[model samples]
Target: MPATSHPTRAAVAWRWVALVLALSQLAAPAVTSALAGDFLASGATNRALITPAGYAFGLWGVITVLSAVTAVVIVRYGLGSWWETGILIDICIVFVGFSLWLVIAAQSWLWVSVVVFGVMVGALAHVMRKLIRHRDDLTCPSWAATLATVTFGLYLGWSSIAWFANVAAAFLDEGWSAEGWWWQFVVLVLASVSAIGVTLMLRGTLGYVAGVLWALVAIAVGAAQRGSPVLVSTAAVAAVVVAVVAAVTWQRLGRRARISPATA
Candidate 1:
């Protein structure tokens, strides 16, 4: 996927849409904070051991920028030449789902927000699964490839971690207790396994691994703060496992990249 000089009218149109999308995402935090007392505060005590630190949410800034960048390059691969029409439609709907989530979340509709996010995540996951499976078949320009990888990977990865927190929030609202150490332990273990499962499935896409790593490490922080060594250790171990797998995968990929096509 070499760089291309031609950015079509369609690319410009996509850029405009991307601009709007970026602006919308930028406003979401402020809008939600004003309407619902900010996401972290809204989580309150029910969020222990699962909520990332206040600094962690800063990652949204990165995603917002990338989302905009995606617009610029999406059709840069020669005006929708690389993407299947269905894939493009799915991408559009996924962003719409993103906007909807912000609205629902702002209203403090926890369960509904969860559902919206689940849909959003599912859509992106579908795209990403297809992408990984058919990367070589993709004819997008270099920039398009990079932008798509970062944008979709981050969206899928972060949302995946957030989904767990969202579910936990709903459970807490329904009379669930953080005091249930046994249940918390079980949940942490399962989340750990799921993160590993995702890593295996993606073959260690860094964006996906990074998101799980962020959530797991942050949860570990919360656990340590609350003096739960068991949860902390589990979180740390899970994070380490993911990191190691990612490293190994990258090495193998590098080796494959080095092999000549004819040799292979």
Candidate 2:
């Protein structure tokens, strides 16, 4: 990939553009408040049987703040050179799509927002998946590339579950009935299992683990508030198990990387 394909005369400036885009969340949240009588909205607490408690949405704030940091360091480390032209372009598209998704969400375009969100997820996942393999493509410091990878991984991981909940809400909105309380409970349990299953199969990345753990714990908390012990226990157990795996994986990986050449 030639630098001409993606290089900017002002790499830092382009990064600021991306960072500002990330900050657009300062606007009214796409997830409308239930108090506003918009329960059908994408972010509303009452959107679905699987919809998490309102408190769970606070994770967005944290994810965005960290993303801002990632955006900055990525350029400083050399975003233009860190990624191939295609990847760089896709990353830009992801930012633009993310902004659009929020805009559509604010309009209560539930289904449209889901489509936009899926696009953003796909783009981001592409960047995250190819990131480590392309480390040699980077002109930035090694730490910068690693940090950006982890940051995106965390956001991507959480967004994975959010997408799941989003789809569940959309279907429920479209009259997909649970059919019974037992089936409803079963669905939620399946969701918990799916979350853990994905996390376990994910490449060895602590950020993915972190994001999944946070979402699962919040899911558990949300279910508890809703008085669903089955979902609560399911989510809580999955979260704990995932957390332990993340810790152990991080420890082992860190140790192996630190091994002296002679010790190998």
Task: State the lDDT at 262 in candidate 1.
Answer: 50
lDDT of 1 by residue, 171-242 (tens): 776778766566677767777787788777787887788777887887788777777888888889989998
Task: Look at candidate 2 and give me any clashing residue pairs.
Answer: none
TM-score of 1: 0.84
> Which candidate should be chosen as best, given TM-score against the real structure?
1
Best by lDDT: 1
Q: Candidates' TM-scores?
A: 0.84, 0.76
Model 2 per-residue lDDT tens digits across residues 1-264: 324235565555667666676666444354334323443333432545455667766777777777777777765556546344556555667667766665565556668767877787777777776775565566666677777787777777777767666666556657676333355556556655765665555555777777777777877777766667777777778778777776676677678778866597
Query: In angstroms, what RMSD does candidate 1 have relative to the true structure?
Result: 3.3
C-alpha lDDT score of every prediction, in listed order: 0.70, 0.65
Clashing pairs in 1: none
Q: After superposition, how far is residue 240 of candidate 2 from its true place, in Å?
A: 2.7
lDDT agreement of model 1 with the native? 0.70
